[model samples]
Target: MNEERAASEQEAVENDVVARVLASFENTPDARLRLVMTSLVRHLHAFLREVRLTETEWESAIAFLTAAGHITDDRRQEFILLSDVLGASMQTVAINNPVSGGATQATVFGPFFVDDAPHVERGGDIALGAVGEPAWVEGVVTDLRGDPVPGARIEVWEADEDGRYDVQYADARVGGRGYLYSGIDGRYAFWGLTPTPYPIPFDGPVGDLLTATARSPYRAPHLHFMVSAPGLRTLITHIFVRGGEYLDSDSVFGVKESLITDFVVQDAGTPTPDGRELGGRTWSRARFDIVLADSE
Candidate 1:
């Protein structure tokens, strides 16, 4: 009888703590804020209760997050990396962008995007200094009704064959990223490095967490794109290499079947789209037509 009474008392204390914390947000002026806070508190407390988290474990979590913050800067985003590995980024994307009307599916936006990326003309080259097989990427930007969406801005970036983004270089070189606009015919094309599979940075807290959990940090080979046009929902997505390894287990959960595409290989003497000589080096080509959805 005494043991049962003690257990009941513990349960009462836990419930009371959650209730008090939630009640404190009852007077919040913003209804959205109040709702968010209430849900957060309830879920957080429930997780703690379910896990029976100890003081030491909580301290460890705090320290881990602190380390992640310390290492973040203009070139690196440890928090987003953490979110990607935990599947939170993908979950948020799914909630915000649902599949409908044949529009392209949205995916996790990795942490490597930078503002003010160098601008390239249509059919221009984005592989300024990166080393890899030359890639010819061409596509059209259109709406659901199959009409051209002229002047859509397209931002593209990808890793080099070395599995490193341009920002990861110590010399601060810029390559493998540029922005272009669709022509009047909705067609856009560019020369870039062929997409390559690469591991996420594995030298920091996020990497440590992945190591601790026995998880892989390698993302599938893919080319990233962010397309925006007037009166359309901006799309952030990727074209994953078809039949590539790691597609089923991409570190960021960014792959969709619709995005998988063939990277067709061409011989050294093949005629290039822009007639640029490859000097006996083989290259690849991929076609990815985009469809934009109306913004609600």
Candidate 2:
């Protein structure tokens, strides 16, 4: 709430309304939760006053949120989708992950992440029959100073050439996503579908909101990565295809210059890092060495 202006009696009543709501949280058990609630109330009330929100509009907002809740299930999360499109997800990530010692910058963690992704061995294929050209993804996990941080768990996922994640389908098949650990040398590798530009799931309330506001639902072509190791900040980020479409207008606004990287094309039968042949089929490869900051 703005603390100072020409105070009026009606405005005093309004300010008192805010004060009373804030006072309600005085007995909250958790200090952090109390502070967060207090801040939220202040902002929310300020918005209501600034916009002079109507009762009908408030009811509409409630209906929208109720629809979001109804659409959210074990495999789909409409609220995270809402947060992504609103830039809330990225804002939270930025606040928690400042530029520290040149560590890889964080970005939005999309709604599609799963708790127990299948494991992939070093240089093993994670595509699991998803459609797209084969690509080799290799990276090293390290500290800000570049020392190897072995045993870092690297979780990865992406959509297929047709721009659909596995979970978007009826079967919820686990393709195009998996996890692997860094080696003693801090190196990890896996095979995945080369990413393509794709839309966020657009059949829910988020989609209706975007349509009503003239927004595009497409995200830039990218592969998701979440790397974690003891004593280092866990990083949720994506490596976008350097020249992929929709880079400038990603629906979720997750593109970062430092995270855009090359997906170098390879000739059929090109010798892979592990010396595997592609049976005369062309492939692509990318290298993304990651750096982690010390945990806060």
- lDDT minimum window of 10 residues, candidate 1: 92-101
Model number with the top TM-score: 1
Give TM-scores for every candidate, taking all chains together and pairing residue i with residue i. 0.98, 0.94
Report lDDT (CA) for all predictions: 0.94, 0.93
State the lDDT of candidate 1 residue by residue for 95-202, as single tens digits: 988887999988889999988789999999999979999999998999999999999999999999999999999998999999999999999999998898999998
**lDDT string, candidate 2, 1-296, tens digits:** 34455457668989999999999999999999999999999999999999989999999999999999999998899999999999999899999999897899899999888887899998988899999999999989999888999999999998889998888889868899999999999999999988999899999899999999999999999999999999999999999999999999999989999999999999888888888777788899999999999998
In model 2, the clashing pairs are none
lDDT of 1: 0.94
lDDT of 1 at 191: 98
